[model samples]
Target: MDQMFQIGDSILTVSLPVELDHPNSQAISQQIDEILQEQYIRGIVFDFGNTTFMDSSGIGMIMGRYKALGMRQDSIRAIRVNRRIYKILNLSGIYKVMKICRQVEE
Candidate 1:
């Protein structure tokens, strides 16, 4: 299992890898699915602090999770998003579906 996952209350936080390509996205999706099956998760927080690159697969992964959570816009979040990732997210229209934050709240 990937140590990137962290659970708190009903939320699942995923610390993404440096590069979010097809292989990485697929593995992350599978891991998140398994965790969801074992526990009731209402929201997902994607930590993109380390993610410098993301392909379309990453968008798909995020969208899949959003749908899995009943398509509630507030059920997904992106934290520690740098400028580059933010542009991608903006262009992908992900900002409309999930909350984006420049920093994680302590």
Candidate 2:
């Protein structure tokens, strides 16, 4: 899985691969953690334009990040989600904590 992080003044944007399943969840989590530690991140924006699959591990990863940022009064957001993934996010209750945006697919 490939991941990229964009450091911003207030928000750290994370772009993850299309398949965020068990195989790469750990790596993704580690990457995110490292970025959070290395930067003064106030919020996270997850770009889901490329993500196509996710599992329980992905949910755990998101939840863990949420907790990590919660301590700092930060927030998380998601963009460019497809229909299938949107349903997963809804069922996982991520919508309660993160803002959802309909971005133009790249």
Per-candidate TM-score against the hidden true structure: 0.95, 0.86
Among all candidates shown, the one with the greatest lDDT = 1
Worst 10 residues of 1 by lDDT: 97-106
Best by TM-score: 1
Please report, in order, the local distance difference test score of every candidate based on alpha carbons: 0.94, 0.80
Misplaced by over 4 Å in model 2 are: 1-3, 71-74, 104-106
> Per-residue CA lDDT of candidate 2, range 40-73, in tens?
7788888888999988898788888989887444
Please give the lDDT score at residue 57 for candidate 2: 90
